[model samples]
Each structure stands twice: as structure tokens, then as C-alpha cells.
Target chain A: MKTILIVIFFLYSQVQSVEPDEILADQELENVARIIGKELRCLVCQNEDIENSNADIARDLRILVRNMLSEGKTKDEIISYIHSRYGDFVLFNPPVRFDTSLLWVLPVIFLMLLCYTFFRKKH
Target chain B: MKYFFLLIIMSSFGFMFYKGLKIDPSIVPSNLIDEETPNFQLKKVENYPLFDSKDLLKKEIKIVNFFATWCGPCKIEHPQLMELSSSFRIYGIAKKDNPQNITKWLKSYGNPFDKIGLDNDGISSIEWGVYGLPETFLINKDNKILYKHIGPIMKNDLEKINAFLK
Candidate 1:
């Protein structure tokens, strides 16, 4: 009974916030929209992506993504259009730019320093 | 030498954490600053004059405000807008709100907008990059977006708004 309940809970959690009305008619386009939505951050929720967020702005963004896809816009074009308006904060995977380069560089530098210290101590 | 490397790493992380603490995560900086205002055409609310992108190009400083009848902050900021209207041309976009509620709300609180637009579908708000209600944008004479205020314009903000206008 516990295993069954766990399975049900997992199934329920998989249900996305995308409303039926927001779904695209074309299956291929809908898949593409889902992929894009998962990458775009919901500005209102901050942490949750537009695909999973229940915020009104997330819904609006999901619809906008679908509309753009149906209008023949490529994923990059759609993402960039929203990015241009909302800026780097709205992108979950932020582009490596002058301002953002530190986020990518700091982790590798920390790792190298840790390895150097570990090996130096052993030697 | 080992301690020197450790100190550098620890201080760098400490510096980043200190800088992060100073920033309020809720305040997302406006990306549209210094950029041309996005193009949009919206219907007039009630009998007010229509507003569009072209109107922003006029050689005068203006304000674009995204508001909704259902939003609490929008009500709080309404008086500031009213005070601003005496000197500035303020354009309002009613986001996802019906005309009836807007008319009634404006009547009770007073309509401060020089021209009000009905953004019933909310596309205009998206174009303007409005994530929340009561977002105000200051537009310069060159039609560039000068500054953006994310929430209700309190009395203190009036001074800042005036400074931007100047």
C-alpha cells in the first residue's frame, strides 16, 4: 500500500501547470514549446522554470512561447526575444558574458585550488 | 604559500557572499533601460484618446505605467500618478483588467492618466517587460527608457522621479 501511494504521488507531481487551452495543436511544436519553457525562468517565482511554475507570469510566458513557436519562430529566436525584454535574469542557463563570466569561472578555479592544496599537503 | 592560496579562495568567496547579501533578489533590474520603448498599439479605455509607440517619440519626457484594477499596489500608487499628471504626460496600460472595473476604479480613485490603454490580452505588458503590477517607466525625450520602478510609487519615490525627470 505504501509503494502504491508513493507511485501515485510521483505520478501526480509530474502533472505540469500548462493549461489545456495553452497547449499547441501541433505535437512537434508542443514538444518544442515544452523544451523552451523548461529553460526559461519564471520572473515572478525566480527559481521555478516557466514549465513548472504556477505563477500568472509563467502561464503568460508559456503561452507566448507556444505562440511564437506556432508562428514559425525558432527556439533561439523565441528565447532571445524574451531575453532581450526580461534580461539575463529570466534565463536559467545564463549566457557567458563579461558580467556573467565569473559565475562560470569561479567554480573551476575553486576546484583547481582544492586539488592543488590536497596534492601539496600529501607531497 | 599554502595559507596564502587558502586565504585568496576564502576571501573571494566571502566577497561574493557579501555582495550578494546587499542585493535584494526581488528587484530584477530593467533590461529595457536606455533602449527604445517596445512597439505596441492598444485601444483606449472608455472615451480616452488612443496611445501607441509613435506617441512616445514626441520631444517631451513621459511616463508609461502598467496597472490593473485588481492590483493593490496600483491603487496605492494612483495618487502619485495623479500628482504627476499635472506636469507630465502619463500613459496607463490596464493589464488583464476589464473596462468596467477600470472605469469604476478610476472614477472612485480619479483617473490620472493622460491617455489610458486597454491591455486586456496582456501582450502590451509583455512587450514592455512588465513582470508585476504598478511598474512605471520613465521615458526621456529621445524615446529611450530612462528608469523603471517596480512597485508602488511612495512619497519618497516622488523625489527620485523628479530627479530623473530633470
Candidate 2:
């Protein structure tokens, strides 16, 4: 039991301490967690961010964020934590790369098509 | 003209989405719907016997509220709860709080609960699936939880609850 405790404690410390190499990983991931947390609305809370909410579930998620930070997890993994639980509604800034590509490009596409159509008519 | 049509559709979509956000997302369908009332006992502050959910069984609807003295939204939702007292049986679960503070808090505002139970440890709250303060549970005649509202009840919610009562 003592050996088990020592091993667990060792892992816990290893997980918590950011090595020099892990520093780059930590800062990058921590920044992402903070930004995503700002955007994702707390599901049970009325008008509160996941970071600011005092709800127990929010606290759990906050702990998850910090633990992931210590373990050297990335931005995508952090967003995925909230995404799996609460859905996209939690995200303040929706990811616009692929699934939401249309949302990002439709305006530019429409403008370009309009300009093209106008030029064609003149021709 | 085409851009104008696009603009109109997009704006309406945005408006509708924002309105939907305003609609309380707490009532989103959960599997826990229609579950049995979680076991809890609280010392009724009116100096009565210890009130438990099992004791409240009757052929009428009941409301269970979880509030704390420190919760600001609880204060805001107090009046709406008071209004519901006439229509249905409402019990208060003071989560992780002091009985004296709760009694004093209610006195300043006014007690809406028929039996306010002191949930001092909040262990009972976990069984009830309480995630935060100002939450409410609507139970049917059979003591089955029909709906759970996560935040403070507002005037519009009271109207909706009234409709359900009817």
C-alpha cells in the first residue's frame, strides 16, 4: 500500500511538473483553455462563462482544464472536453475551418459571384 | 435584390437563434426525466417535524427549490416562487447553507416554501441532481420528477409552470 501510494504520488508530481520542453506546450495549451472557456457558456448557469461559473459542474470542468494543462494536453483536446458534454453552444467562437466552412466563406462567395455575373452581363 | 434576400434570411436566422438562446435551456430533455424523487430530509424552519420528499406525497403537483443565502439569483427568483405557492405545493431545499441565515434571508424577502428544508451538507442535493443554486424541480402527483430548471425561475417560467399545473 505504501509502495502504491509512492508510485501514485510520483505520477501525480510527474503529471503536474512542466519540464523545460513542456513549457512551450503548457503556455500554448493554457492560452487556448482560457480563450475557449471565455467563449463557452456554462450550460446550467444563466449568462456565465464556464470559467466564471460557480456551479459544481463548472468547477469540475475547470479542474479538467487545469489537469489537462498539467498533463500537456493541447487546445483541441480542451475544446473537445466541453464539446462532448455540452455541444457547440458552449463555444463562444465557433470553429470556422471545415464543418463551419460555409459560415465563413458564403459571404465572400456571394460577393464574388455577384461581381462575376455583373462582368459577364457587361461582356 | 439577391443580396438583400440573403441579408434578410441571415438576419432573421440570427434573431431566431438569439431568441432561442433566451429560452431557458435548462428544460432540455434529459433521461432523468420522470425519475423518482431523490431522498432528502431537512429540518423545516417553521419549527416543525423534519420534512422529507417522501412525506409530501399527495394527489397534487409539488415544486422543490434549492437556494442559498449567498445566491443573488435566488433573491431575484423569490417573488415568482411566492406567486406559485397558491397553485402548487412548493418546498425549499436550502443547499449547503445555515438555517439561521436562511430564516433571516427569507424574512427579509418573504418565505414562499411550504416547508423549507436545510440541506446543510448538500449531499442530498447531489442525489437530487442539483448542479447549482436557484434550481427547481417540478414533480407530478406520483413524486416523479417531471422537469428540472437549473437557474432562478422568472415570471415567464411561472406562467409555463401554471400551464403545466392546469
Candidate 3:
């Protein structure tokens, strides 16, 4: 019973929103689509990735990603295409531009300060 | 001096969080503003003539709205849209909606669109980077998208829309 429950939990957690019709026949291409989908933010949901979102836009994006992959577009090219259309908000990991540099640096700065404050007190 | 630096850093972070709290994260800014409108030629929902993006460039300014029959907010926005129609060249794109339903809905709600495009596949909405229904885009004669308003347009938004149209 415990083993069965664990299996059920695993399957439930792994469930994705990719509909059967959207799946590509080529396994390699499908893998690429999955990777791309995981990276693209669902514009409607804002917090969820397109791969697991049930929003209509997310479904459109998943289909678009699969189509692009089948058309022989590279992963970076696909990402750039989406980024160009949707802007920085569509990216789960925002690019380090001048404005975004502070976002990337501040966490490190905070960590360094915490370490310095702790070590200096001990010494 | 070190304590003062820590205080400044903590205060700045606090200030940033306070400002961030005021912003609604769901309202992502459109990248298409000031850029050329995405070219599309969709069949009219009922009228024989198709809606070509080229036609939008002929006017001084135009409004293109993405709506669906099933959307509740779109129904709410219809009357205000009708009020704006007399002054603006407002075009509609019925996203993934049946023509029959749209025709029926228009008849019941009152038709505000100068031209209604049928976006059955929703490809046009994707090209426009439309994530939500009842989104409106204002474009100039140059085909540049001047503004994009997501969700339902309210009374306050009319002032802004008028400013752009003017």
C-alpha cells in the first residue's frame, strides 16, 4: 500500500499540461520542445512555465515551440524569437542587462556582507 | 562607518520592496509599443471584406481590439467601445471564436466594430503578443503600435485613449 501510494504521488507530481495533439512524433524534437517550454514563462500565469500551464497562451506557446523545433531552429534562436515578441518578462531567468545587473549583484553582495559580519565578529 | 553602510543597504532594499509592492506584477509591459504592428490579414467575422493591416495605415490612428464571445470582461467593455466608436476607427479580432456566436453576441450587445476579423487559430493574437482577452492596441498611420491596454478598459482609460487619439 505504501509503495502504491508513493507511485501515485510520483505520477501526480510528474503530470504536465501538454496535450496529446501537441506532442511531436520525433522523440529528439519532443525533448527539445520540453526543454524550451520549461524555459518560457506563461505570459498569462506570470509565475508558471508554459510547459505546465493550462492557459490558452501557454498551449499556443507549447505548440509554437514544437513547430519551431521541427523547423530546425536552434534552442537559442527559438528563445530569442520568443524574447523578441514578449520582452524580458517572458524569460524565467532574465538576461543581465545594465538595468538588471543590480538584480544579479545584490544577492551576492548580501551574502558577502553576511559572511563578513559573522567572521569579523568571531575574529 | 561600516554600520552606516549596512544601514544604507538595508534601507535601500526596504525601499525597493516598498516600491515593488505598489506594482502589479501581472501587468507586463508590451514590447510592441512604438514598433510596427504585426502584419495580419484575417477574414471578417461576417462581412465579406477581410481586415488587412495595410488598411490601418490609411487612417491617422486606429484601435485594434482582441476579444472573444465567451469572455465576460469583453461583454462589459462592449458598451464603452460603442461610445468610442463614433470618434475612433475601432477594429475587432474575435479570438478563437465562432462567427455565428460573434454575430449573435454583437447583435445582442450592439456592434461597435468598424471591421471584425476572425482569428480562429489565434495566430494573430500571438503575433501581437496578446496574453489576455479584451486587449486593445492603438496604432498610428505609420503602422506603429503606440499603446497596448490589457484587460477591460475603464472610464479612467478613456482619458488616456483620447490623449493618444488626439
Complex DockQ, candidate 3: 0.73
Which candidate tops lDDT? 1
Q: In TM-score terms, which candidate is top? A: 1
User: Which model is ahead, 1 or 2, in terms of DockQ?
Assistant: 1
Candidate 1, position A84, lDDT: 92
Query: What are the per-residue Cα lDDT tens digits for candidate 3 across A1-123?
Result: 999999999988865899999999999999989999999999878789999999999998898889889899999999998898899999999999999999999999999999989998999
Q: Per-residue CA lDDT of candidate 3, range B1-166, in tens?
A: 9899999999999999999999998888899999998888686766535677777878578899999999999988888898889898888998999888988998898888888888877678888988889899999888899999999988778988889888
C-alpha positional error of residue A38 in candidate 1 after TM-score superposition, expressed in Å: 0.5
- Candidate 3: which docking quality band? medium
- Against the unseen true structure, what C-alpha lDDT does each candidate score? 0.91, 0.70, 0.88
What does candidate 1 score on TM?
0.96
Q: For candidate 2, lDDT tens digit of each residue in B1-166?
A: 8668658767866886798788866643333467777666666665634568665577778888889998999998999988998777788888767777877887888877777778665556645655567788788888887877778889888877777666
Q: Provide fnat values for all models in the order shown.
A: 0.55, 0.13, 0.61
Q: After TM-score superposition, what is the CA distance of residue A80 in candidate 2 from its true location, in Å? A: 22
Predict model 2's lDDT versus the native. Answer: 0.70
Off by over 4 Å in 2: A1-123, B1-30, B43-49
Candidate 3: lDDT of A8? 91
Error at B62, model 1, angstroms: 0.4
Q: Report iRMS values in order.
A: 0.8, 5.6, 1.0
Model 1 interface DockQ: 0.75
